[model samples]
Target: MRGTPTLLGRPVPLGEVAWLTVVWLLLWGDLTVGNVLGGLLASSVVVWLLPLPTLDSGVRIHPVAALVFLVRFAADLVLSSFRVAFWALRLGTSPPVETVRVRLRTSSEVMTVLVTVALSALPGSLVLEAELEDRELVLHVLGIRGDVRATVQADVTRLEGAIVAAFGTPADREEIR
Candidate 1:
């Protein structure tokens, strides 16, 4: 499944084995055939049994873009964690955690769900609720730096863009801007 394989003319399963193998190596902190084989089997089985829904055929992932997205996400996750930690350090005078409604850049359900997952995966934000029809999420966020509403909305847009860059069509990338 190299070079962006698609299932039923839809994009999905973006190197599932590769992701799992990398995760396995990270967990084991060693590169070995046993570990690689183990990851391949485990990941393949899971995906085969419970696969993610395929994205529309128009969705196409550029390898470079996906790599860039992964790096950016890791950096964002670390930075957001630090920001949340700094906020936690503030004792009682902590800024209020605000709920903001942010519209997503992609209207596709899968893309929207991916954005939702990305937002909830971080510590600073949680998806309070999802309005699928409207392609919006009510997110509760920490660390209101300057403008609470705009800050949250911008962060959400950034997160969505990262995902779109990693696994979206050329059209998706254009629409995000």
Candidate 2:
């Protein structure tokens, strides 16, 4: 409802339609015309019955930026996977571990949430806590080879750049450091 709007005086339920289509596709496993028609009918009925939200503010996406974000995310995932594997294979020794605090550039809640989610998904890094009021994040990291502070800060900056590229409005060349 927050992200959607009403049509005329009533809400046009696109969410219900989408759900019905998915359920029908899953249950029937057939893409025949009759099945498609039935699914559409069911979806229409559900939408008519339910007070669904409308898409007033449509989604804005930048294709090139989205592609770049995906590429960087995949590469980071692979690198972090290898780092985690290497750390796991360490023989009878605990690596230097520390929690580093990183200050984020963008104060966007969406950007912050995305960064936290992506960092958590990566293997070698964990988000300990995020201080939204201060615009900082604490990360628990393993295998501190060099300056932990600098490394963590750089990592967070990279993540912030990726998020900005993906979601932020198009901008001129502005260094996010």
Whose lDDT is greatest here?
1
* True-vs-predicted CA distance for residue 11, candidate 2, Å: 6.7
Q: Per-residue CA lDDT of candidate 1, range 6-109, in tens?
A: 55564436587678768878998888999888977777666666777655565577799789878888987899898888878888876568889988868777
lDDT of 2 at 115: 84
Clashing pairs in 1: none
- Please give the distance, in angstroms, between residue 90's alpha carbon in candidate 2 and its true position after superposition: 2.9
Error of 1 at 176 (Å): 3.2
Query: TM-score for each prediction?
Result: 0.63, 0.77
lDDT of 1: 0.79
In model 2, residue pairs whose N, Cα or C atoms come closer than 3 Å (at least 3 residues apart or on different chains), thus clashing, are 5-54
